[model samples]
Target: MTPLFSFLVLSLKFLSADCKTEAGFCSCSCQKKELIMKAVSILTVLSAAVFGFFVGISFPVQITPQLQCGILPCSSGDAANYSFSGTSMIGILWSAFRNTNIQSNGTSENHAVTKPKGAEKLPPGLVVTESDLHMRRLWGSPKEDVATGKYLLALAVGYSEKANVNATVHKFSDEFDVVLFHYDGRTTEWDDLEWSKQAVHVSARKQTKWWFAKRFLHPSIVAPYEYIFLWDEDLGVDNFTAEEYVKVAMKHGLEISQPGLDSTRGKKTYEVTVRRNDAGEMHKTNEGGRCPDVHQRPCSGFVEVMAPVFSREAWTCVWHMIQNDLVHGWGLDFNFWRCVDNPEEQIGIVDAQYVSHHGVPTLISQGNGEQEGSSEKVRARQWAEMHTFRERISNAEKERGNSAAALEEYHP
Candidate 1:
């Protein structure tokens, strides 16, 4: 029977028959027909509202032209806390998570996340449509330092060797979106094309290679990747895997997590400082990378200068450090200082897998001498700037959330 009819019949029977819920308190003042109509009215109203809510969002969504970070909120049955699940960040149950940002004060238990920053300022294109309804598929934004979204992996390589689409896109044992920039390849505007590992000819590099970073590598790349591997033409690894590295990174949040870098004839290692309690899983080791020491394998400050992974968050912090401030020569590798020791980003070194720089360094010995010396001067200036950035990061970290024990890791 229809719900209205069923309710009407039951009400009439209760009124006439010996049925009562709580005796005197269960007495119905309203007529049976009146009670039945009210219940039906409420149900109909509720059903319509719910149906409307769904229909409102039925069409494909569009990205709001303006860049907005997405994130998800947590819910019951969720792990109660977010974490990296080796590949995709789980816990994001839907798409609303994309609206979260630092400024948003929302109360939700579970959600996924997009990176921070971006806005649309188009007055003419403000009209809405399906194409731009960009959603990260996660529910909402997460709290700070909480695992909320996927960090894209990116690579910046020289266009010459990579000019003909010759560069190989390394696969993470886990899946991730990898964006490649064949910077300023010939005839391309902005002059470079954003591509993945597709076999196609890239353009030639623009002549204005900054002596320091060499070519035009934007700071924007820092926003997309959780960790970016800045690599040159020759990077090879017999056994190093990206999936293993992510596991290690979660164990130790470092600004620059350079896995035990193994080079041609030697190894150099740097330890990331963290305030781990004695009971924590991170083993304590002495100064050098010796065991019983429990620290890590060998490391050279610049063991290979070939491929180094800089986490997206870490890279963004690093981007502010050197972008536009330093000209050239401090070298992106050497410029990255350990935030592990400072107040800001304490970078750590991990031991998982290693990548080898396959290209051999060859001296051309033909550039103009004055020009070379000028480049050297520029590089030296960069070194000084790098140190300045390091100090600033340390200062910032301390201001945000420095603990009393944080100073224990600071040698200077």
Candidate 2:
């Protein structure tokens, strides 16, 4: 045999020997071949795993489609009607992802995702809702019909002749939503009048007007109304029309204001606050040298508590300032200007449409059944309460002088 034939014969013999093993079932290259084959198997597995991962990323699973209602998702039944669009799907996915993230942090998703209670889900920066009060509708009233004349008139009334309050109800009932705070336990005919159906009656025996206001006329309760009139029951509204008064007050930009006091019928009336038929909406006349600096603000803005009206903005500040113990708002008039930046420009007496302060302490007249002999004792108690209120206001002003000065400097 030649060298090539010898080599071929040797290779065949080696392969046949390798195929045979002591165990007699397929064994080859006991160390070197085993190692090489194991490496190849690992490489093949790694390559397959990488390829599978890429395929999964490229063709992701689609979740069940959903539709939206306002800022929230629609129910399953409602979602069925509409096919999922790419844009809407993206929004829904984004919202779900946010909710998921919130839940992951151990916080409830409702506060962040759901709309406010009883409030329409409005877009950001649009203030369509205030305090979530379900506004009561009254027909033929300026408060309902006129855009700028949205106001609520709150009267502090007690057991007296219903005829007195009824007269007021008849005259201005078409212009205001009259709310009566009954201080007398004895029932009256207030609910019997024709317009009484439209009014709100709150009963609490022997509480002052300020007391009722602090407890009841909260910002949330009166949030729907533009102005709040905390009036006494004895006001004579013969010349006052709510429409004209609101028009004039809005035109003049009075934040804390009132109808000018009728000079004839009103008592404890300030010279500047007294009504003048000829004067226009705004007045700062320095009569009898009371307001020496006529040009200065708040000199003319002063109004008595008996018939004062507070704009929504002004009422907010006034509400905070009211003291629960000081039920009678005696010193409030002096500090009314604190609520406004430029009181001279924003506060005024509505001279054209004025009311007569009947000067009757009707509430106190209905003496607390146990405490009094007559109206004289009630008058004395009122005097004492008012005096204490004034003193308390003085002390408060002194204590909070620095803070008040800072507030006065605040620009709106």
Candidate 3:
């Protein structure tokens, strides 16, 4: 029994003896004193039993060596066999309870209880996965067996451009994750190429690259990649190496960049994209009369949508700017500056690692034959989409300006 309970029991016995010996001197009669003593004796015994039970359990428990080691750090050899004292065990339990209480109250300084400042702006924990090319082992962790690539190379491809696509995939090392958006629904045929087995194939017949990107490449889905290469399959990568291009882009701090187009080859729609033999590794070209100013697009901060590389941060904003209906991405290139700060410096072309844009009318002739005025029809749609995009941006700017004016007026 506990010392406290034993003392209480002894005091009760003494009181009962005193009552019997000085029955006349006592405040109550002997009969009443006997009844009261009987009740007090029963209660005292019951209370003492309960107190003793708690005291017994509170004594130092013989924990196994494994459990003791888990509770406290164990040194090698005999130290691991040592048992915890009652005092030490109690202290450990009290400490654990106190920590749990602090966490439950949400007042703990621990990371689990309180988030760091600016954590709200951080991206969520997300990773992209592709279909396994081979059967997985039953024993090992799935993550251990999977090889995650750092960069992404996404292409909109047709079966006709298989040779060019194969050449393009070869330009990139295994560090890049290849994802082919098949517009012709001929995914099985690509299996002939060795790299095709590892690549992720997303088949959607007669859909534009923009449409595929919008539907599949959500910001969260591709968040793990350092950079995303969204390109058309018609591009020639004879002069380009993905690793070298990344190095040049990183050296120049280009967030939104592209490989420079060969001057003589490909449709030179924009003068800024044309590769300069005299220009060092990369350059921000200036189209004097075409652009309103040297700081603007087509003069600076410009790359065609045919082949563009985006940093993870920049692509998040660009992905949102892509319209659902306007899959052509005609006018989107002009507004690419909105995604980055000081676009004149961050957006440019890598001249050292350039690509030849083959103006193959592969995509234009998908649903319809090239001889049946498909080119004209596509061009007309592009013009209409560009007009709609410009109007939307203009309207958005006007609304924002009006809201700011009203807020200022109200405060003043």
Candidate 4:
């Protein structure tokens, strides 16, 4: 019995003796003593039940140290061997309590218990596990397992433009890894060129450059290259050399740039992209009445999508901005400023090394016999895509505004 129960029993015995001490009513006194003893017995039983309930509830707390001993290594010889089975109720309760305490304390041990092993070591977002385009020999140990080029040159080409493509490839030295995107599905025909064996080729019939880039040039796949040159196949690279262009871009810190279009040689669209004879290496054009602001596009902070060169960091942002279905890349050049901090300074036209835009009609001629009607249809689709992109941007901005307002109201 507990100490309280023993004390109560002794008091009941003393009360019974006092009741018997009363003379002239021994019978009544004995009855009263029996009644008092019965009351004491009931009280003792209730007290024991209450004590047992408390002990049962506190069982998990009492075993917490033991549970810790099982989870973590203990210096004590006895505790080191202590085993805890989670199958029992007490063990489950202890585990829950331990986890709660650890989370409240904000300890790294909580992360260790919840996250998978080696999860913290991985980079954010999806990781690419497949090998790159770098070729390997089958016979012997190679000096290097990957491509040594620091830059990447990707072109969307057709067999009709083979002569122009060959000239463009020669402009870039061994420091670049060449990748050809064949829209005509005619890769074997280009084998006549000696460099075609070394270049990587991807073929699909009647697809635009944007479509090829979106599906193939994921940021992770091209992470090793410092700069990526995505160009059209019809450009004349007579005045352009890959090495000199890179040096000029690096000197001026151009993150998103393109070669200036020769005014006298080929078809030109934007006045800003026209090469300035007076500029040294790079120049940002100014349109007096066209652009409302000096920092806006079509004047400054812009590069055409035809022959754009993107730094690795800039391309990571641009890759996400490319809409999957909008393969024509309409209105993409206008929004390129969003990827860079100061587009006016980082985005420019390389004047010293410039190209002639041949304005080739490769994709327009692929449709059914009516070339003029097909060209009109292409223009109509480009217009529709531009409007759709603008609408999406507007909707996103409104949603962001609403969310911010709601958050502020909740906090305030």
Per TM-score, the best of the predicted structures is 4
> What local lDDT score does residue 267 receive in model 3, on the 0 to 100 scale?
68
Clashing pairs in 4: none
Candidate 2 vs 3: which has more TM-score: 3
Model 4 TM-score on a 0 to 1 scale: 0.67
Tell me the deviation in Å of residue 228 in model 2.
Answer: 1.2
Q: Arrange candidates by lDDT, descending.
A: 4, 3, 2, 1
**Tens digit of per-residue lDDT, candidate 3, span 74-190:** 532224225332223443455564453323212221222123335533332322232322324578787887667788999999999999999999999988888999999999999
3 or 4: which has the higher TM-score?
4
> How does each model score on TM-score?
0.41, 0.60, 0.66, 0.67
lDDT by residue for model 2 over 1-412, one digit each (tens)? Answer: 3764565455456545644556644455554355556556765876898787656544434333677786798753345335332223333445554453323321222222333444435543453334412236566775564332257888888657466677666655354666788888644566567666656678888778888899888886678678888888887888877777788888878897888877787664566678877676656454454555565423465776888888988998888878787776656776787788887777778888887777776666566556557778767766676667556656767786643442211111
Better of 1 and 3 by lDDT: 3
Greater lDDT among 1 and 2 belongs to 2
Better of 1 and 4 by TM-score: 4
Better of 3 and 4 by lDDT: 4
By summed lDDT, which 10 consecutive residues of candidate 2 come out lowest?
403-412
Superposing all C-alpha atoms, what RMSD in Å does each candidate have to the true structure? Answer: 16.4, 13.9, 13.5, 11.6
- State residue 123's C-alpha deviation in candidate 2, in Å: 16
Assess candidate 4 and give its lDDT: 0.77
For each candidate in the order shown, give its overall lDDT on alpha carbons: 0.41, 0.66, 0.76, 0.77
Best by lDDT: 4
